[model samples]
Target: MLMENLLRSKEYWSLIEHGVVTAPANATAEQRQAANESKLCDLKVKNYLFQSIDRAILDTILTRDTSKDIWDALRRKYQGSTKVKRAQLQALRREFEVLEMGESESVNEYFARTLAIANRMTSHGEIVQQITVVEKILRSMTERFNYVVCSIEESNDVTLMSIDELQSSLLLHEQRMKGKQSHSEEQALKVSNG
Candidate 1:
């Protein structure tokens, strides 16, 4: 969260791209002042970053001079190298492969779980296509959802269909099933009474 906020700030842009100023040996008064101001700005940004993070991290970066150093250190520690990212993505892929809609879970719950993992996969640099998600949803759902899944596959372009549309259809089907159950209960009560 702090990282996201810092990335959004102007100071971060300056630190990462232009970097802090360094006054030359033969620098004029105005030039020295400008360089000092730039260094002050970097310090303020670094302080804000330190405040946002935990004490453990603070200790690790205490020796860092500029905001750029702190930022890069944090990024390296958390975001990891390319190999680390690849390993993370592979783990997420395994989790996705075995992801199944629980028999007792609601339509909303299942979609939420599925999208969370999908979003994580995307964050880790895996390109999870809409069609892949749709196919996963269609195949991994409970046995009761077979009819709706088949109908969706037959009537709509699964590749073009968004996850929201699929969720809506499943939610509607769940509502209809509940309504039918209540109607059947009413009919049974009436038959017994009459």
Candidate 2:
């Protein structure tokens, strides 16, 4: 061991040139046995898991119906999610179906190409009958959007102040007549004086 250390100290790379590992020739039997035991231990632990480890785990998962756990696992997998994403996707689909949200160009393009349709519907100086139809459609769509966004609890304001009642309360005949006196005697006195 002293001789090997002396050689290693002299020149480190000289041992490699001479094709030799400067192991301790005078090592005790106990030291040699310990080194051998360590080598064996390392060899045994090498590549402990077989290639089938992944297949085994996959097989166990496939055989089981882990629906309850799956829901939990899926929830955990997706961190910080509010509502599930679905409405915008549906809206996009509707847009594609209608071509309004799809292969459409612009308002100018629509007018230029669909002149007869525009003329028939009376769109923007095209047709006269289109106004009522468009108004009715707009009213229907407005009511639908309002119904969707508002809940029953939020609709109490609408039930209170109503237009039908307001219209009924208005005395239209009294407002329309010109110089209609409250008392008929005043009118007769005015006529006699004249």
Candidate 3:
């Protein structure tokens, strides 16, 4: 996709799509000039492909006659079959569905975990919405956050809340929980020492 975008940006994609142009012996001067220009563009595209690949892969494709051949070879070598892709997507979906925040995990840590799976799913062609992620986080948080989750759900329109906003709110609640626990511990220590 990156190579395609680059070629598209430079208007060189047609050379790859249509192969190199060849003017016949009886062709007009303009026809010959156009063919020459197309061959030059094909070489440029080939150069770009050669530079992007590693030494080992380049060696395997060195015998390919044109940029289109090289591109097709690379695509076949790297792109998995439909069945394999489907299986991988299924696994990712299961992982996302079972995701839950760990007892000692911080808000950022949980968010990172969830978003990583979500991103992989997205790359596999799944449409993961922000609201779905937010709702998942809210419902899958540790039991200690139950009150905070309920309060947030009650006070906010979750459908409109961005993931960042939800994360920020949960992080503030987590900090307050930690602060209260530490303060209580300090009070208990003072009483015992007294």
Tens digit of per-residue lDDT, candidate 1, span 31-114: 999899989888878878888889987999999888888888888998899999989999999999999999899899999999
- Candidate 2 collision pairs: 122-127
In model 3, which residue pairs have backbone atoms overlapping below 3 Å?
none
Q: Estimate every model's Cα lDDT from 0 to 1.
A: 0.87, 0.34, 0.92
Candidate 1: which stretches are off by over 4 Å? 1-11, 28-37, 40-44, 47-59, 182-194
Best first by TM-score, ranked: 1, 3, 2
Q: Which stretches of candidate 2 lie over 4 Å from their true place?
A: 1-23, 47-194
Which is the better candidate, 1 or 2, if ranked by lDDT? 1
The whole-model C-alpha lDDT of candidate 2 against the native structure comes to: 0.34
Whose lDDT is greatest here? 3
Task: Score residue 27 of candidate 2 by CA lDDT.
Answer: 72
lDDT, candidate 2, 1-194, per-residue tens = 23335435644323223322222678787877765654443332221211223564444434322222322333344322323224433443343233321133332332233333333333222233433323222233223233422432153343353333222222232243223644566889889998
Q: What is the lDDT of residue 142 in candidate 3?
A: 94
Model 2: how far is 159 from its true place, Å?
Answer: 46
Ranking by lDDT: 3, 1, 2
Scanning candidate 2 in windows of ten residues, the lowest lDDT window is 43-52
